[model samples]
Target chain A: MNETLAGWLQILALVGALALSFRPLGDYLAHVLTCPRHWRVERLVYRVGGVRGDADQPWPAYLRGLLAFSAVSVLFLYAFQRLQNHLLLSVGTKPVAPDLAFNTAASFVTNTNWQSYSGESAMGHLVQMAGLAVQNFVSAAVGIAVVAALIRGFTRKKTDRVGNFWVDLTRIVLRVLLPISFVMAIVLVAGGTIQNFHGIQSITTIAGDHQSITGGPVASQEAIKELGTNGGGFYNANSTHPFENPNPFTNWLEIYLLLVIGFSLPRTFGRMVGDNRQGYAIVAVMGLVWAASVAIVTANELHSVSSSAGHAAGGMMEGKEQRFGIWASALFAVSTTLTSCGAVNSFHDSYTPGGGGMTIFNMMLGEIAPGGTGSGLYGILILAIVTVFVAGLMVGRTPEYLGKKLGAREMKFASLYILTTPGLVLVGAGLAMALPGERAAMLNSGQHGFSEVLYAFTSAANNNGSAFAGLSANTAWYNTALGLVMILGRFLPMVFVLALSGSLARQQPVPVTAGTLPTHRPQFVGLLTGVLLIVVGLTYFPALALGPLAEGLR
Target chain B: MAGSLTRLLRHHLAALRMLLVFTVITGIAYPLVVTGIAQAVFPHQANGSLVKDGGGPVASSLIGQRFNLPSQKGQPSGSPDPKWFQPRPSAAGPAGYDPKSSGASNLGPNNAGLVKAVRDRRTAVAAFDRVPPSSVPPDALTASGSGLDPDISPAYAYEQVNRVAKARSLDPAAVRKLVAEHVQGRTLGFLGQGRVNVIVLNHDLAALKRR
Candidate 1:
């Protein structure tokens, strides 16, 4: 088959598969979060934790549950890394350093697996399984929990409570992430992804060369790594590593897994809001942006005038696996960034200037093109709230969204949610540029170097863990700075989400009036998307102009 | 005030206990169960698909290994043996093809350093393959995303067919046929590129007796 046709077919296949799962998976998610009855395992878990299964938390208490669980998770993961030398299956490696430990701990806990140290070497088997993998489950669940609380705000009336945080957390892990990951892991293993507990094995090659082979329980991690949109790799090469993503089949499956939860959450939103089209509207916006970015990126890649035959031969094949080619690689890059999953089958740093710009722009859209696991639904919902507010201002009326009045309190939280990441990214990157110590991590000089700094903060603050990979970011300054950025970027937006939910919950839902903007229509989707693009474009334009935009112009 | 403080403490404790319980289920059980099933089902694949020659394991088919002859008295280590088909260029680690230290060079497109390196690589590969610099596939000139990529594009595989045939005094048609036979299509219809596994193709080449 022709390569471009093949590429388009792959994209079509992806869309077809996602469209198939959109309603079922979304409705299942809504059911999992809202259903009152618990499984035996869940009941036992709640009993062990000394929390009543039926108990609910208002937004404040829900926020408290999230904070407390996350704080302990950080401490545990940090300790796990520090004590890797003492742990069995340390694989002859010593403990991780304090700063990297802090960074990795915060990174995983925030669902941003921004790995500094290479996985196969720096982390032992026990830590990869027990610490990092565990966070993939809970961090994603926590995101789901927060979004569930926000959904509860819409579903309930005259209530202080959103939902039981502990109950939501347990149910999501057991009923949602665990079972899916179990089947997916075995499927990956069947598809030639390696799964073993053995440490690095020394082997002789056919050419009489001594080579040490590294293999681990990669299939297990690879499952959640995509399914939960947690992009940490078992190998340093990430999904590009044939061990983690062996064949084209697994590659497509992995991409599907990355998007399933994020995309389907809109259906969950629609079902909860008593309007499936509202969900469809948001998804339509997400799909348009995602497809457009992928097309732009793929075309730029194939149109690589970088060399004469760059067009006839495949597009800029640098930093891409021949197995994936240009089309799949471009699709994966746009998809990974669109969600918070940072696993790349091809290196983004090696992408053409336009391709690179589109990717960073996707992240700058705050990854709400069906964002991360639970995070995506909430992120877009928050944006929806902001979008309605903007529309209302234009029409000179009070903003009402999903039959709930967006009052001053709700607007304040929405404003804070929208503004937080850009503030963190720009200010953080700006400081890194100005500071002498932090400036040393720039491997590329001039404009590209500035790109590394901007990409780091945009990636970290937005919790998208993919790197330009050009940045030497494991240094004390970069690690600590990014670590701080990851924690605040994640939890602070979360705080606003919960608070906004509570405020919305407190307001008696307004009946739909003729004056109210119909949210499920194309006009509304266009408005929400425009609001998203303009907000991100306006906020990050100068920094972008300095980095990717300038590089492309040159 | 005291009641509230106690309530907060209880909440924190419950949170900790929940984290620990869920950790065992997700962290421990899930991985262990998956690993057990994989081992029971496909032990060979679970242990890194070690391809054997004449009943002895040689190398993993998944990881790319350098096919250079052992270092001569004064020659550097990485000179091609010419008896075997070469895989794609790799910038994996110090002295390349170290599976233990697998990763890309991570050079961005706009970086001058990457441009210079690509230029150098293009010149070198074109010289080796007896082709002009412009004719070399980007996969041939630039490093693969995984430095340990086991396969090369079919175009790259075909480029080296004449040289391999000449070095071994074999028919060019036979080598070309070998490359053609080994070129695998995208899986289950479409997913990745149509790629030639260098190791497996070469293993088949080694089995073909020289003229």
Candidate 2:
């Protein structure tokens, strides 16, 4: 309990610091991604690329451009990975295994870095930096661009074009992401996070024995990895690595970095849509939900481990980093689960039954509590729209959100995007459970074991990428199945959302009148929250009952 | 209407072209550039953080190595080597810590089977450490979820200090101090519990014996 109290104080302080820093950072990002002030460096980049930043394409055109960009990106990334082993053979690395390559490619492309292979062993320096790290930035940038486009749909009146995809992508990377990454990388380096290319060093231990130290330019990838909410690590242990996370300060920084960008984006959304209130409302909804979920998950994790059936006389201390304590680790678990980030300091599989259930439930809800960059905001908006629709049905009036009427077209797109991942998750889990080969992979039978498999598919299919890791998902069947899920989970929803954006762009923005439902009000917030839970609950309740809840009872 | 539709399509086609161009540049090109920088800056780490043999490349920095194997062939009669620190108990297969099938035995506390397993494990630890069964740490008897845990609880390490020291004919106090030094405290003085790296400590003990 003492440790828990101290942990909360530390986490609250980190959260407060992050809150203060967010506004300026958010303003800067909004300006960089949307404002058209050209620095000298920007001019040089444009000149070198022979790119003109002048084109203002309409909404349909924007969609086409985004699609084309993504297609080419996929091709280029795939090719780079395929050729990486040969090109990087000078560095003593071979081509990645075809299956692993396929999995890695899909994982990064979809903003899901669900790694079945060790990063340091399987990948070359060039591949890690160019193929994987680059996607970390671009994938997040794409998400931001999509969210920006969606906001344009909400705010625009009698407009066909949302915004230029090229401009938005450029602004997101150059103006917003790059600067923050630069500062954060330096800060991480200062905190003893290694940023070098030196060979692994063999240092004599404090006990007078030699042990090899693994070193890399981790600070560079680490900053974006956290900020983008992508949880792949330079080491297999992810944030648990001493060089990567280093100390308590570094761990706190990583948590803040993961959350700050996500928190600020809603405010950015508000500014973009010309409605600060709307942004605040979204933030309020997201924050409340995130806080409640984190609280429940953390309390369960601590309590479950502490209780320990009285057999373990000590506190909840197994498979945990002692430096971080239970509260910090518990908080980290909820934070990582809430966002799509999968960096873990403690093993979630070791958590008590109830605690583990809360974690799976968070993932099953699609990590929409300040989710991955653009995806979280947009995902929540779908819920918001659904809430408005339900409310409208109750009142016998047409539903509207942020001045846009909830029409059939919007509803269809939102429903499809929202439903796709759960379908993949539930179906994948069902198939895995029913099949003998998959069942044989389970180390533990019944509820807790079932939860592990369910958690993996749910994480992969949602592009959340965190896993129980207890399941033997590195096999050929799992590799293919989970890989496919990651791709479809990410892109299918994105494609639909883009199409929805295009549709919404063509329609005139409806004015808010007496009959309009106020989304920012408390009642609507409750409705929005209920709508999110109901949709997730209905879609995933059966699977949940079979996995975590059942495991808890047993 | 057809003419207007075509015009709209054409307009979007150009936008799509721009979008494709930008996506490729940022998505593909940017990743390549960053990867190149990382490689050039940190070559060893850029390579898969592989830990090599005395001669050259062998295993990885991230993967756990196997230790504490039984000396006999299909004989469940002999005890494990006291000199080598053991990893957390695993239920993977005939032998524990099998990467091919990684997992924990999901046994509830109240289950009779679980109680028997725990009691049996406690008896083994008590014999190994020459201490009361109650003194042995829970982390020692319990199987970690991943089963590939490279670390052990500090108390678990401390409990085994006497046996390891006795086996190697070293000072027990020195060994206990070494274990204490190796113990990593909670994250931020509050995140998780303290633990010791069994592999690292054992390796050190071996080096000390050689010295």
Candidate 3:
């Protein structure tokens, strides 16, 4: 079969899988979040933690619960990294440095999965499984839990209470994340992903040479790392590592897992709010944006345009596996960046200017085009609110979205949610460019070099953990700055989102009238998609112009 | 104010307790259970997919290995042994194909250094195989994502057949047949690219030499 034909078929299969699962998975999620009776294990967990699973909390209390858990998680993970040398399964690795430990802790807790340390050499088995992988489950659960609260905000009227944070978090982990991860982990192991307690094994080659191979509980981590949209690699090569993603089949499966929950989330939103068409409209917009990105990236890679190295090699093969080639690599890059799952099967820095730029652009769009696990649903919902607000201003009427009126408080929260990430990205990148020491860390010179800095900040602020790996980001400055960006990026938006949910919950839902905008219509979908593109595009245009566009055009 | 502080502490305490409980479930029990099942059902794969010669482990079928002559003192890279098919250029470690530090060159597409490296590799690979520079496949001139990638495109593998045949003093047609046998099509016909597993191919190549 022709490679181009294969690429098209692969895309069709992925979209088909996502479409098939959307209704059942989304409806299941809605059931999980809203159902009153707790599972036996959930009841046990709540009892052990002294949490009242039935008690609904106001938004402030819910926010407090989230913040407290995240804070504790960060501290515990930090301590685990610092004390790994003494821990079981230390396997000859040393304790991580203070700054790196702090950075790793914050990165994982925020669901960023960004890494400043090489996995094989820097981390031991205990830390990888118990510390990092544990956060993969909980942080993703926290994201879904937050979205559930927001959904309750839309569903309930004339009340300040959203939902119980403890209950939501527990149910998501035990019922949703863990069960799927368990099955996928075994499947990954069957496909040759290593799963063991062996440290580094020394072996001889067919030709007389010695090789040292590192081993760990990789399959388990690999499963949730993709399932939860946490793309931190157990190896530095991430998904590119043959053991981590042995064959093309495993590669496709990983991509599907990362995208499954994110794409289906709109259905959950629709079902909970009693409007399935509204969910369809939102998902349609997400699918359109996601498909556009995939097409642009795939075309740029297949042609190898705007890339001198690609031209010299006669194709874009650098930093790409022979098995995956250009098509699979580009697909993975677009999906990973569009969502907050930042695992790379190919190095983006080595991609053609247009291809790499589209990836950075994907992150700049706030990963909302079927974004992260729960983040995508909430991100697009906020944009929907903004779209309705903009439409209201144009038509000289009050805006109501999902029965909730868009007022000053709601609009303020939505605006801040939109502003937080781009602000962090620009300021962070600007600072890095201004400093000579940081500028020296870039491996490539000129415009591509500028892109490296821009890519890092955009990736961090968007909580998308992929990198232009040429940036040498393990430095003290990057570790601290990007770490700060990840935390602020992850939490600040949630603060606004939760506050907005609270405000929406307290409102008496407005009755539908002739002036009310029908948010479930195609008109609204087109308007929302335009708002997403124009808003994100306009904000990041200058930075992009100075970076990928300059290099690409030249 | 004091009451608020107490309440904050109480919230934090709940968080601490929840973290510990969840840690026991997700962090400890979850991984251990997966490991047990993987070890039980797929022990060979679970233990890094090592292939053995006689009783000794030779190499992992999945990991790409270098096929070069022993390095002379002060040489940055070893000379490619003409008797074996060479893998793609790697940027893994100080030396390439180091599994412990798996990574790419990470040089951007337009980077001057990367451009220079590509030119150098094309010339070197063409010279080694006694083929024209244009005939050398892109995979031959570029680095793999994991410097430890074990596979090379079928075109790259077939390109090296003549040189290996001449070096080993074997039938060129026979060597060509061997390369053809090793070419693996995309999984289920439309999933990925066609490629030859370098580690497995070379392992079989050694046996062919013995024959």
- List RMSD in Å for every model shown: 1.8, 5.7, 1.1
Span of ten consecutive residues with least summed lDDT in model 3 chain A = A204-213
What is the model-wide C-alpha lDDT for candidate 1? 0.87
Model 3 agreement with the true structure over B1-211: per-residue lDDT tens digits: 9999998999899998999888888889999999999999999999988989999888999998878787667553577889889988898887688899999998998888889988998899989998999998999989999999899988889889989888888888888888899999998899989999989888888878522
Per-residue CA lDDT of model 2 for A392-461, tens digit only, reads 9998998888777778998999889888998899899889988999877765566767888988898898
The CA lDDT at A152 in model 2 is 74
lDDT of 1 by residue, B1-211 (tens): 9999998888888888998998899889889999999999988888889888886677888888888989678543787777788887787887677777778877767566667777777787777778777877778767888898889988888889988998889999999999999999987566778999998888788888777
Q: Can you rank all candidates by TM-score, best first? A: 3, 1, 2
User: How accurate locally, in lDDT, is each candidate?
Assistant: 0.87, 0.69, 0.92
Candidate 2: CAPRI quality band: incorrect
TM-score per model (chain B): 0.89, 0.71, 0.94
- Local error of candidate 2 at A177, Å? 2.0
Fnat for model 1? 0.73
